[model samples]
Target: MLATTPKPPYYAVIFTSIRTSYDKEYIETAKKMEHLASLQEGYLGHESAREEVGITVSYWKDLESIKHWKSQSDHLLAQQKGRDKWYAAFKTRICLVERDYGFEREEQT
Candidate 1:
């Protein structure tokens, strides 16, 4: 499912990666990070997908929130694990979302 984000003026942390391999630990850590992010102070929402390459875009209220998430202890460990084991390569891009729009189909009974 797509993330339901607030109106404009938020931050988007786009994490794109090439995985070395997917293991049980990687799956568990990814789930943990998703849950932890949802509980954070300024987390908006996130959307993720994995195939040949993995992409996860997490939404935040501001840069401070993004920084806090980065420095979070478990997340820090996850980062190291990614470097050492999980990811062959990765790129993270933080951007200011100035404007946005989308369309959603209506639910039918």
Candidate 2:
């Protein structure tokens, strides 16, 4: 189960993707990136999953943090690889959440 983040004004960036049939070291790189992201300053919380495709949602304290993460050198390479190889298509959406709360079946969205 995914854990709830603290009360906010927070940035929620959602990444949803469909993977290509080609395979490489994606799982390894993904784990490494997750580790790196968790250690990043302003990283609040994250949730992710994979099946026929994948979805990852990462929370940040502010836009600056999100920008820093986006521009990180290693992550930039990964983004390029994603565009070139692993992902056939993807979509990202950023949302601002204020005073959020939730529970199963009846999430306080």
Candidate 2's C-alpha runs over 4 A off are 104-109
Give candidate 1 misplaced runs (Cα > 4 Å).
Answer: none
Give TM per candidate.
Answer: 0.96, 0.88
Error of 1 at 20 (Å): 0.5
Question: Local error of candidate 2 at 94, Å?
Answer: 1.1
lDDT of 1 by residue, 1-109 (tens): 9999999999999999999955749988999999999999999999999999999999999999999999999999999999999888999999999999999999999
Superposed by TM-score, candidate 2 places the C-alpha of residue 59 at a distance from the truth, in angstroms, of 0.5
- lDDT score of model 2? 0.88
Q: lDDT of each model, Cα atoms only?
A: 0.95, 0.88
Best by lDDT: 1
Taking all chains together, the TM-score of candidate 2 against the true structure is 0.88
